[model samples]
Target: MIKFDGIAAFVATAEAGSISAASRRLGLAKSVVSERLAELERILGTKLIQRTTRKLSLTENGQTFLPRAQRILREADEAAAELAARSGKLAGPLRLSAPVSFGILHLAPALTKFIQEHPQIEVSVELDDRFVDAAAGGFDAVLRHGAIGDSRLIARRLATSRRLLVASPAYLEREGHPASIDELQHHCGILYSMREGDWRFSTEHGWQVVRPKAALRANNGLVMREAAMAGLGITLLPTFFIHEAVKSGVLVPIDVGARAEGAELFITYPRDHGASAKIRALADSLQRSFGNPPYWDRLAS
Candidate 1:
């Protein structure tokens, strides 16, 4: 009979390049890792690795065993995950990631309420504009706006984010509003530096591109909204962050006749996390909070 622990240690040592490295990764002592590997070699009646002062090299038999060992470990993990899913009890740390603006305006409040419900679950959220690697970074879920590039991830549409060309009524009165997309060249624009140097729009007439002279450039969307509200210039913004401002008459939409390409909000996680109770609970709570046609979609309508 082959011992699973010995096989796991052998695989880890192979992947990590040494017993010491494997021990660090597995949270075990180097001696334990070495003992497991030796036991595995004894069972197989073959020396799997040649330990040298300079490096660790795998023998021919080790090369053949590596793939099989990894497969077995993966299968065992999958089986454990399936069993955990069937139990239906969520009790672990759940890591999440989201964009800066949306995370603050929408997701933060919703998460606060959900955490109150599941007090046992520890939640950690990372807010940034860049996309997070959910699997590698240990994030259980991510809330994202705009297009998702990776085909490996499964995305569930949580909301529709309408990007409106808007400015304060005071700014419109003082500088005159852009009646058409072409007229934007005459007005000062608040540019988001990360969106590249130009603004691309999809209209009924096909695609139109504009590169307006920016009076102020900002990396953060909230600051851009503030700049626009302070009568700086016209800015393209998502409804999710500006819904309250639009309703309260702080900001008014401009060039409404020519609409820009609206972005979508997705609640995405690894396909593997689908079976995790903690991930599922958080996802369900989020859907309940923001998924009913979404608040942003309602605002746009």
Candidate 2:
């Protein structure tokens, strides 16, 4: 009979290239990982890894077996999760990756609430704003806003994030408030993820585009928000990111005769996984938590 723990240890050691590294990655002691590897080799009557003074390398058998071992582990995990879900008590691990700002501001709370509801669920999260390969990262799903550009992943719309033009009261007091879109264009703007252009809004007439002077630019929405709060310049950002500041009167909304284009928040998973039971449970939790129009939108109103 093949044991999963041994296979897992072998796979980790093979991929990590050293027992010590695998131990840290798997949260197991080096001796334990070594013992598991030896036991698996004993069962198969083959030496899997070559250990030397300087380095470790996989034998041909180990190289051939690595992919199959990984597949088995994945299947075993999926089976356990599916059984738990069918019984109406989801369990096991659910790993995800998300944008740093959304992960900190919104996703973290929702995850906490769900975990509290299901104590047996073990979750691992990676919060980053960069585009990452979900499969390569080994995340069960990803939380994202904007286009899912990867055809390899399936996405579920969680909510619509509406962007609004905003500035600190101090910024408005310093720079003078812009009463219309035309006037708003005259003010230098804090931009997110773009170097040359600034604002894009939807108005009663049509889509309106403006290229304001770039007061500051960054890849992160939080950076732009912080810049706006520091009275650097007016910024158009999502309500979720700025709602609390706006509600606290630290930032004020500007009616610039158009609505800044926002994005649809999505919870996506690799298409190969086919929306596993555990992933569905997490998605449902997020959808319920966000709600229609989202809580942030209501608060901003």
Candidate 3:
């Protein structure tokens, strides 16, 4: 019979990149993790991973079985979670990731109330702007802005994320607002340093690309927003967090001749965890907290 402990050991070792690392993650002794891996290899009558002092790599057979192993663990958890659902009591370790800005402005508050309501549940959150893999990171759920590109994950919409080109009143007054999308290309822009592509606007004809001259560039949205508010240049920001500034007339939305393509606030999880009650609970809580219009978007143009 296949021992789940051994399978888990093998999976952890492979993912963690070292037995010692896996031991730390699993809270098991390194020797115990090694023995379990050896036991698993013996039971299979084959070597799964090849070891080296410099690096450890999975053998061909191990690579083939890795996905199957992950599936097994996922299904096992789903079974236990289904049972917990019947009791309607949330009590499990929930790991998730979210973008830093959204995490700070909105997610943190929602999570505070969620954890208060489910004190028995344990929650771990990672706040970063970088892309996080639900499967690789072993997250129960991940909150994200924009679109879900990974087909392996399931996405649930929490609220609208409307991105807009905005500028301070002083900047527009000094530089003169663009009369149309085409004229926007002539204005100075405060851009994101890690921006993927050129600025895109949805026009009457179709989507159009307009790249403006750069006056300032930043990697963080907060920094970019501050620069725009300080009369740097026009920049694109999500309405969810910048709505207050816009409402107070600190920044003015530009609608020269087209609309900026916006994104949605959503929660995503690995398809394997589709049946997890924890994911459902968190998603439901976030959706309810944000509501249809989202509190921030109330006065946003």
Highest TM-score against the true fold, candidate: 3
Compared with the true structure, all predictions reach lDDT values of 0.78, 0.84, 0.84
Q: For model 3, what is the error of residue 238's alpha carbon versus the real structure, in angstroms, after optimal superposition?
A: 0.8
Please write out the lDDT profile of model 3 over residues 1-301, one tens digit for every residue. Answer: 7899999899889877999998987889999999999999999998999999999999999999888987787677667767777887767677789988889988899999899877867887889898888766766788877778898888888898678889999999999988898788888888877765547878878888777888987767888899999998998888876898999999998888777887688888887558488778878888888877777777686
At residue 63, candidate 1 shows an lDDT of 88
Task: Kindly give the stretch of ten consecutive residues in candidate 2 with the minimal lDDT sum.
Answer: 192-201
Per-prediction TM-score, please?
Answer: 0.70, 0.84, 0.86
In candidate 1, what residue range of length 10 has the lowest lDDT sum?
Answer: 271-280
lDDT of 1 by residue, 213-243 (tens): 8989987889999999999999888788787
Arrange candidates by lDDT, descending: 2, 3, 1
Query: Candidate 2: misplaced stretches above 4 Å?
Result: 1-3, 10-21, 34-70, 194-198, 203-206
Tens-place lDDT per residue, model 2, 55-161, is 99989998888868866766777899888877888788777889998889998999998898777888989898888676545567888878788888888998987
User: Candidate 3 has which clashing residue pairs, if any?
Assistant: none
Clash statistics: count for each candidate: 0, 0, 0
Stretches > 4 Å off in candidate 1: 1-88, 271-275, 299-301
lDDT of 1: 0.78
| TM-score, prediction 2 | 0.84
